[model samples]
Target: MASTWRTRKADQKTNLAKRRSPNIAEVSIPTHFRCPISLELMKDPVTVSTGITYDRQSIETWLDMGNTTCPVTNQDLEVEDLIPNHSIRRMIQDWCVANHSYGIERIPTPKIPVTPAQASEILSGIAAASRRGETTKCRELAVKVKAFAKESERNRRCFMSHGAGRALAASFSAFAAGPLENSKTGVLEDILSALVFMHPLDEETAWHIGSPESLDSIVLILKCGDLAGRLGAVLVVKELVSANGEWVEVMANTKGLIEALVKLIKEPIFPQATKASLVATYYMVNSDVERMASRFVDLGLVPVLLEILVDSEKSMCEKALAVLSGLLSCEEGREKAYEHALTMPVLVKKMFRVSDMATEFVVSALWKLCKNYNEEEAEEGGRRGESLVEALQVGAFQKLLLLLQVGCSGSAKEKATDLLKLLNGYRGRAECIDTMDFKGLKRPF
Candidate 1:
């Protein structure tokens, strides 16, 4: 039956291919006409509005050489204009013929039904099954779990059930350290990431009792050797260190965490995993944003930040923006560092990307980074003080001005206005530090 169907399909395509070009699309190839590297269509097409074109052979050569210059106009295609090769042209034609012959579109691929909760449940079940030497059962469950966990945690409130949440995490850890220790199967990183990093346990959730003290668990989990475990551990540590740490103290203790964090950042497995680690390191270190700025600069974190900023796939730019904020806070040669930051246009471009500039912590950071260098200056102070003033002045005053004049409906705008007053001079800066508003701000942007 299959062979007969394929033969009929071949006959149908032969009929279509033999027929004259359909009225669906038209072409009038000229002397200098060629296929666009982008559309790959042959026509008397006008050169792009950008005013660039090339010859027929030139177009083919460019299409062959991956040159994005317009065939007739000779203008180079922009980063945004460069189109991918026509990958599915043949497949599309086959579909057209097959559809005209078969009279039905292809059935959609069956979606694998798996939630994060379900994924975690499977991992837990695997550990339970593996412990009793149930290899077959473990393999069966693993087979059903798809290549990746796509579902996000549905409710932040779910993790508020501190007892169940902690117990579930502990149990997952136990499984990894116990029977699964020797199993050649993959370590349970996805499961753990879903458990720890997902919605249930954010800062406001406040269900877990592990503030600062539970730091060891994350380290242990990372050491246990699973991507989920490592990420989970990193999340836990990040949450813990941040439960409370002054910037100076985080930077003061930076040495102890650097080696461990560097090891995590260098890991090749997951870019998100490495990014989370470096960002956490960038976050965990306590310093006047100035004090630790040079170390990260010396360690060559600037270029890595630019790389993450341009990658739009992951939300990694948030962290990269943060590291930029911290770098802006540095006083010593801050302009040079700012110059280096301009290398990637994305970071500067994306600063005002948030909805509420006043309340969005990164916005304030961007505010500081974007300002006129002198008026926002704080060079008279120590490295830390200078960095802080730089942060306040870096376009923050302008954002604050906009906030004050235009105003925001949210309370964060009021808070930002309040924070802005502090930047006006030492007295206001002292007032900002002396006031209570600064406490909740340490972790956000």
Candidate 2:
């Protein structure tokens, strides 16, 4: 069936070419002057092992999409090699120039494709630099690797298949552990940025590079490195947590990882770094490790998150709110959040201030506090009542009522309704409740 289809296509192309040439007096380009695959003028013409010439992109698309037979010949391709049809390409260029009055533009020469061998040689050089602690050489080679990989899909696959990804990762791990005095921290950061750009690399290679020692090195970069380095390290850590399955827990337990992340959150040199730190922290806290979640609270992350919320743009606000929501899932997290002076007001102020997502996170967090803190716990000397009283005193009940009146999301409205009920049940005719005025309730959304 496939052979017959290819034959039909070839015949159709031939017929089209014949039809196009008959009107040449009207500036009609001969169909044979175009690639059969694209039905357009060819650029970067190359012939396959099947003796059929095609535009390089069109043929590459054919093979990349899993077709092994030649489009024009209907013959099984003997090899995957593409030999540049320079003679034919030059002819196309000359014809275009001759037809310049007809609005034809000559095709410029295409860049020489990087061979797998060239990419492999660069990888080998990077590995050697790793062994010799040659930071400058490693940075230069790392740049070359990134350049080649960015040149073409074929170059990227070549690097992946020929072990360039693994080699580069190994080199990163080595330099990450080397003496900081020997190499400028910027060099190490460049190597890491190279890895971040070549993501979804081999899973085994990812694991080999994301070892405990390497993770510690990355965390160190997060703590004291330059802004770009900090941003790159966060991305690298995000990738490791995603690719390395159970290795996430390993990273969560890495000695200084959490503390470094918290510090980054508190004093992010760049906005992207703060966002990435929030993501990295989200991953670790989402690991569902009890001790890990508590440690975030212990490190005073809640208040830092609170501070971040004050000036955060919508996206960052959402993430900070989410982390707060997650932290509130446990007793320690709740205690920390309720204890913070700005927690209630910030949550209230951001209720309708940011996006729907931010509102949802805020509502969910407040609901967690209201629903979970019980009277029995209050009788036992818990701060549940105190927190609730604080919520009520700060017009939390009024905000809940306003949320429902001014129209929030279905989920937010439901949570608001429940919170109003919870607060009303706890304190009848609460002092703050008398101040509620439905006429004044208004929101941008």
Candidate 3:
């Protein structure tokens, strides 16, 4: 552990350097948002003397609720982060309520495969070679790492997990920044690929997060402000928590994970579509539910996500709708979801807007969202309270029924039937059933 005096000494030296510099520093706005508690222009912008100042109050709320650090600062920021910038607190409050998702979710980066072990072994060998002044060996090792990362890309591979991928990517980057690079596009491409692989995309594949080594690597990876790298990492952390079902006890350990995940909103490499997708995805990572209903909720995510949900691009729409379904699922499970859910309506209208593969993925996502409400939450299966049933009653029911008619295998047919049966058992469900005309209801025991 680092000692306090050491930390203080470093802080003092940093202050001295800043004071010694000829130019005064510029106030840093997080490039991301207006203030939340008070949505004004976030005037009381506090850039720490140490050069890291996030709105303390916002960071504090996330932490006092048992989070470990500020999502923006990755600092030891706790409740003190909530110390309001008294000057602009009111303005910040207004902005919080006014800002919407700008109709974009920076999409999660495209995924790649390179194994953590493979990347690690190669980077370590290069680092050792560099230390020994063996430029030849270092260059050779970098070549191998780049080649392997490239090969994994060719396979259109999904990463092992976000943490593992990022850790591996960080190591690769250290090698690239130090020993590799010559203004060549090929070298630049390798760096970019490594960036994507640094953190796997959310649900690009299932997240496997029990590995301590992978987690450690993830912490190292978050140090670099490469926007794409951190965005991928956040999705992995958020999705892993999502995959864990409601094990909030296991989730407290992931506060560091959340901080890394939220930090992406401040970076530039994040596009409007990708950013919206991430907020929708990560916002759903709260212990049991997504925080969409909170008074302090980040509403800036909504409009952007809605845009992608309606996009003409099949892959983009598929991902957007998947995030929407996850968001809608959380809302639907509770009766309160009525005020916030727009996903089902948008989904129904855009149902036929894409390629069959993308359509299949979206339908599968919708199915899982419904399935969780039906099968997993059984005893609490107040079908009346479920968002899935509510969606069925509105407009999306026909689209789902249409999906059932598609020429898929018997298993797909069976799953759809099972979901239908769950909704059918609910109190005002007959009205929804009346909307679908699939008459061949053969009972599959």
Candidate 4:
């Protein structure tokens, strides 16, 4: 441990130097001086079988995590053995001594990591506790595991190696299997929080959590839990879907699951939750199934997305536009979009307001609605003509002309040109016209 005064003196001097120079790259730290795991000065350097050196503590933690491959080399480790790199440690110590005036403190030797036998014993204990339905001990173990995992990348692997992730998953299963009493909610929360750190979860672990009961629990959290719980559920769902989307599709297709996700977007939650929901929804909908599109419409997804498009930040607007475009491609989706008052105007208005991505998506949405228009109803000036008429009334034609004249992407210009030609027939124009002002238009044909 560093002495208080010494640590304070070092920090104060460092701060003073930063205040003086701001860009302190003039006195650069050597690359070899830093540990790959912590990116700090390495006190106890050690070499793995892959011939790459890392801090002893970091490599040990990594091995303890159950990772059989070297983090730096990505090669399979011959064994979990790590040799002390005494020469590199001495070099770091000497450099620190030489730079003493610059507030550099020599790094102290790191402590030994827990042995394999000891790690196995801890995991066995947790597993046994889980089997006995000891929720309190399970929660405590999860908290400790998450704490360790958060300390460094190496620690995460180490914690996972000890079957902590499986134990946490089991704890969740146990908690979810029982009644969701207020007292047990905290334990569930702790377990979920721990699971968040073990991202890109393996297929087996994902299979365990992607069960119907577990998915229902996650959806319930999205509905009733706090921000952290909702965010955790969203991330966990994303991971599960990514690991095995077909498995998640079965859960995502359920009305309750779809409704909960749509409701999440309508809620005044932060954009992270909303963004995650969008991605999960996109992944679930990325199939040739018609029900996916209809499900979004049945749950009133268009209007919710319209609201999101209006006030959402730029990135959110892009995602909302993409999902909206996908939904509009289906016949039912087009009908649902036409039902909304702001859908046409918002789609047209966003054509030039956001980025190129937004522009392309908005135009695609318009093209879909136009391509799917009922010819008989359009000729009769019925409900099918409402969207086309609204597009004209809202100056969408003017925007498309402007995009083509001012130079847009090939795809955008292509779709815009096709839409312009299609609209000309509806307006009784004899030939294509480059018109902007929507007011003074007679049957120029």
Candidate 5:
């Protein structure tokens, strides 16, 4: 009996192997199942008005590239007239299943893109929920909208076209204006999560969120919400400032907003948040707007930026130096930078070590600090500040010389040349000589 059972099991294993061992090349795919444009099997086949079927993605690409005719028929085609060929799609699935032994995997059903009408209906529901103080209902609808945005690029474009950005902004504004409660935090997070998908916000929507109430809400989130929420808030600020330059002033004026942004850099929660905060801060201060620069300086943005330059990666270092350079334009900014212990050393350390843009910014900042360091002051019995001496102490003189030799931008080279001339006055000072490391060589003095 045992021998007979073993023979039966062996026969079953042989049958299974035979079923799984079809040569893929021997099985020919039907030509009709292939997309005329892609020349591959159709996954989501749709028929155009010209009575020709093509893969949906391929046809969409064709139309998006400004072609009004079908690829195969060369007939006038309207994108809206493309209809899903359900029968053909079902047949394709069946064929894949039959060809399972040839390593053919069945394509899953494609998600239907959200129509403008559907997006409008969802936004209306969210608005009604907000009006009735229905936080739970609002959260539910917001999650649904977020899912649609995440489903595909087409759905996100639909949502943006149908005022989803404005509606979400209004919901967030209401939440910010409402009482702060633990139960409502989920609603805020959901709204922010959805809003994040609505990038490149339209001008009106950007202005809508740039309001004082909405700005305050963002600040509140940065202070209290979780990491995702804080990140979303900072990203929104970045988008807003980018979309409209006027919003930068409004953001700069918002109470605690600058402080909150600076704090994110000081004690970073995540890299995205830190970088976004840096970009936002750079925009706000990168103007002749002395008030904005002063605000950043007063909030101690300079030291935090110098600290970032010490250990941050290349991109982060670039942004930090950009913001620091902008801040140095103001009197208070220059004074604050002069006070920091790490300012001179950090600036010199980043010169040739980072990219050219970073080197340029470093050179510009050093020029700003030391351009006024007059040799005439020392000759007139007046004191020369420690900034120039500190520059030499940290090997700024050597770095600048190397920077000029290797070549740099026109502006950067000019600034570096001027910096070399200024620091030359302090090269032989006894204090600089004592603090500077000469390695194995004698002092130039």
Candidate 6:
């Protein structure tokens, strides 16, 4: 009877022990389960070429920071060297489940990663659908591509490596050639959004997108599409135009392309859109300076650029000045600039206040205007001195003198000196002296 009573007592003690919840800190986790890099339990273990396993996040972060060697083994490692260790991940999940009472949660099984082959297959489907004129199907496949890209950085890299950019550019070119209706706008937007995922496009892909049909489609989107679509279109244009001079010339001559870009600058939907439009315009005008500048000037680009210079931030000021400088290379551009009320004053204000680049552009533009004024004065028997006098009226002399006082780039220093001589010629004029601030004036030399 005493033996039976002892057995019952032991059984009760065991039940009580099972009912009690132990603190997680008391559990001894296996060392092998921890990632070598993070020294924590590996959620998604991956083996590298060095035959060492690490948590995927930990090693990817290491590689992204430009380390080409394995953290544990010091062997050369590349991103493609990573291989998922499924057995270890499953073991981790099982361990967490068994330790549930200690507050350990089981890690969910990870989805199979995307591969380059899979990305290429989806792109092939898109191309086939585009060829068949199945707009809806093309859009669905594009969404799938975009979904894959959005899933992870690995997936994006996979898609980009598999010619996703060229495929999407072809698909865009195909659909954009059709009639643009509300239904088609969704299709185009999906394609454009996916294309944006494949950015920093290769030259071949850019060549495809720089076609006349693609440019016309981009212009339409810039005019009528939603904000995201417009931004994507402008950004794509910016990238394509930068690819080659031939593309730049093509974009410059495309009907309504420059006008659409200028409109975006005039009524900016966002800062990036405005900047991208400015960059695109700069490239287009710069390609064929004399002809392209006249086209942009006809679109009232000069006044809009002047407005950006007057009120926008430093970066915008710099880009606006760049476009203005290119535009000033043509006679028509110079005339438009001279006619604008804010041109001289705004240029003077931006000097040394924005950046070295901005100062250079400003000096170049002013030199053009003053030089033109001198030519006109000689041709028209010295009657067209108003622009030169206006430069002095806005304190151009003082700014130029100060620029010379401090220092500037080689080209800017030369332009500033020439401008000083021009302004000095007009210094004794009544309009200049009346508007000049003489207070605290001192010669730098």
Output the number of the TM-score-best candidate: 5
lDDT of 3 by residue, 1-445 (tens): 4698899999999998766543412323334345443343343444333344344434434554786654545555533223334334444444443332232222222233344555556656644654454545654554555455556442223223323344333433334343333322233233333434443333322332334444444434444534544444444445455455542333335435434433443333455425543543444433354343331124333344554564435555665555444444444322222334444455445655566544554555456556646445544656434566556665455665677776555654665576666566653552454323323332222
Clashing pairs in 6: none
Model 5: residues with Cα > 4 Å off, grouped in runs: 1-47, 51-55, 82-110, 178-184, 288-290, 339-341, 376-385, 393-410, 425-445
Q: Highest lDDT, which number?
A: 5
What tens digits encode model 6's per-residue C-alpha lDDT throughout 229-329?
89888988887776666777777677877888999999999999899899888888888544888888888888888878767888899999999999999
TM-score for all models, in order of appearance: 0.40, 0.67, 0.37, 0.68, 0.77, 0.75
Q: Which stretches of candidate 2 lie over 4 Å from their true place?
A: 1-62, 69-113, 150-154, 176-180, 184-187, 201-203, 310-314, 340-363, 376-445
Clashes of 6: 0
**Number of the candidate with higher TM-score, 4 or 5:** 5
Error of 3 at 333 (Å): 6.2
The better-scoring model by TM-score among 2 and 3 is 2
Q: Give the TM-score of candidate 3.
A: 0.37
Candidate 6: where are CA atoms >4 Å away? 1-58, 61-69, 75-113, 147-154, 177-182, 375-384, 430-445
lDDT tens string, model 1, 1-445?
9999999999999888757344333423233233444444332222343644322233444655686655556666643333222233333344445544334333222232333465557656765764665545654554443233232122222222323245334333444443334452243443345445333344432333232222333444466556655766666556544555543254335334444555665443576666666566656433445456666555556555555555444355565565656665654324534544233134323534533431354544544443433443445543335544544434445555666676565654654565555556543553222211222332211
**Ordering by lDDT:** 5, 6, 2, 4, 1, 3
RMSD of each: 19.8, 12.4, 23.7, 9.4, 7.8, 12.0
lDDT of 4 by residue, 110-216 (tens): 54454456556666766776678777887777677667677666566666776666766766776777566776676677778888988767766676677666777
TM-score of 6: 0.75
lDDT of 5 by residue, 92-126 (tens): 99999998879889988887777778899999999
Cα displacement (Å) at residue 426, model 1: 12
- Give the better candidate number (1 or 5) by TM-score: 5
